[model samples]
Target: MRQSSAVFRMIAPLIAVGVLMVGCGPSPAPNSAPSLSPMPVPAQTAASDKPLRVAPAPSALTPPVGSLYKNPTNNRNELVLADVRHTAVIIGDSQAMPAGSWPQQGVAALGYKLHVAGMGGTGYVAGNGKTGNYIDALQRGDWVLPYGEPPLIVIEGGGNDATQHATDAQITSNADRLLAALKTRYPGSRLAMIGTLARGINNGGGRRTEVDALLGRIAAKHGVPFVSAGDWLTRYDAIGDLQDGVHLRPAGHAKIGVVLAQELTALGLAARPDSAPAAK
Candidate 1:
């Protein structure tokens, strides 16, 4: 499917984020809104390059500034705003593509709507010999912020770049440009970065590790939370979760969702619904 370079679109982040998966062939589902799903946990697997991060325990994080209140309509014990005003803007390449909607479950957990946009074969520095890179795509307005005012933003990429042997400078410069555009568009939103996925673990080894490190440095420079996938293979038992090494199987997708939800909770990005009351 060839999209006009001038046309910008907004789809629920992973509106199915559907089969738009890079390696998997197919366009994303046409739906423009994301679906919400609960998060979960993955049975333990061999330790990945990075030790498996086991949350010590579920502790309530401090509320963001004001007193929280539970939405009277809510069925669970929680705190936050009653009505949802925030959106989670997620962008990436194939990894961000459809294989599985990695953002839906976690975004739902945070009570924010999800919006995703990305070219299946594109990334910051590579495009699988097709499509434009993230920087150019954003510059050309291939897609824009669909969710009105997003409180949280996530940028996922790097796999294609390393596989295609993108120069460090190319990756760095393009990544910088992409981040600039995101901040410019959603100045008030909190941002986070998810790095390259690996094959064995440690980002599938080789060049991917370098790419993850580079992306991490960029994230650190920008002061946004960064989730590295260098050890993802072992951490998530990716060998069984991946369908083709890059795209995920259903189980892989579920594990990723749970892990991401936990990270967002830890970051205090998705502590409670918008309507939950502040702790006494």
Candidate 2:
């Protein structure tokens, strides 16, 4: 009994010393919300009490309709929209200067005002079945051109030439001559051509189609944009806009006006009236 009591006493003192040593060691770190985690908080403000800025989302502006066109007849790019502030000159046959004034209405919307020089029987050429070719008429002082050498000059013919059976040679010669004369007359103004109307989109087979093709070639030679009105009407599904497949009804005239306006714009021909070229 005596020996057991002594051994227990010695072991008790050593166990006490070990517990005291552990307590003396550094205290355990406090239990924090796990080391990796943090609470979300509102962004801090500057001394001026201004809110922190966040970049605005990206935005893009789109161009307006009729702002541009890839000219179907020539594969050329044209600007169809611009300030409606310039004067325009239009030369054509009966369709252009029809009995009613609707077609010209739309053209007039393109600028400050538009002028037309045309007669029902006149055209780009005369011969087999046609007469009063445009070239001869313009040369003889037979036609009146207002606002000469304006910002935009549009020459449209060949309808009479086709109907009257004007020969290809005559058509080409007269068209070229007329183009040259216009260039000479309005050297500073931009020029464009509008081809003849047709029953269908294709240049199927006939004098009219041949005339259209011929005129297209001539326009290309002149480095100008030729709006194949036939194709244009077909493209816009506006065949119904015409009456008798040749003349434009009021609706047709409106369509022509809108389309022509766009074409003129696409060519970058529209400008402020004050910027237009002065009369020769």
Tens digit per residue, CA lDDT, model 2, 54-138: 5555542233434544444434333343432255767888878863343465456665466677677678775223335687776
Q: lDDT by residue for model 1 over 1-280, one digit each (tens)?
A: 3464323344545544564564567555895433456355454657555445566544553334224433233222222332225556678776666745665565556667666767777778886454588878666556544423356778888888887899899988988887887776556667888887775333347887778888999989877888776667667776687788677777777777777778777777774455754220
Clashing pairs in 2: 78-266, 79-265, 79-266, 79-267, 80-265, 80-266, 81-265, 85-273, 129-164, 130-164
What's the C-alpha lDDT at position 111 in model 2?
A: 59
What RMSD does model 1 have? Answer: 32.9
Worst 10 residues of 2 by lDDT: 76-85
Q: Which stretches of candidate 1 lie over 4 Å from their true place?
A: 1-84, 128-130, 200-204, 271-280
Clashes of each: 24, 10
Please give the lDDT score for candidate 1: 0.67
Stretches off by above 4 angstroms in model 2 are: 1-85, 99-106, 127-131, 201-205, 273-280
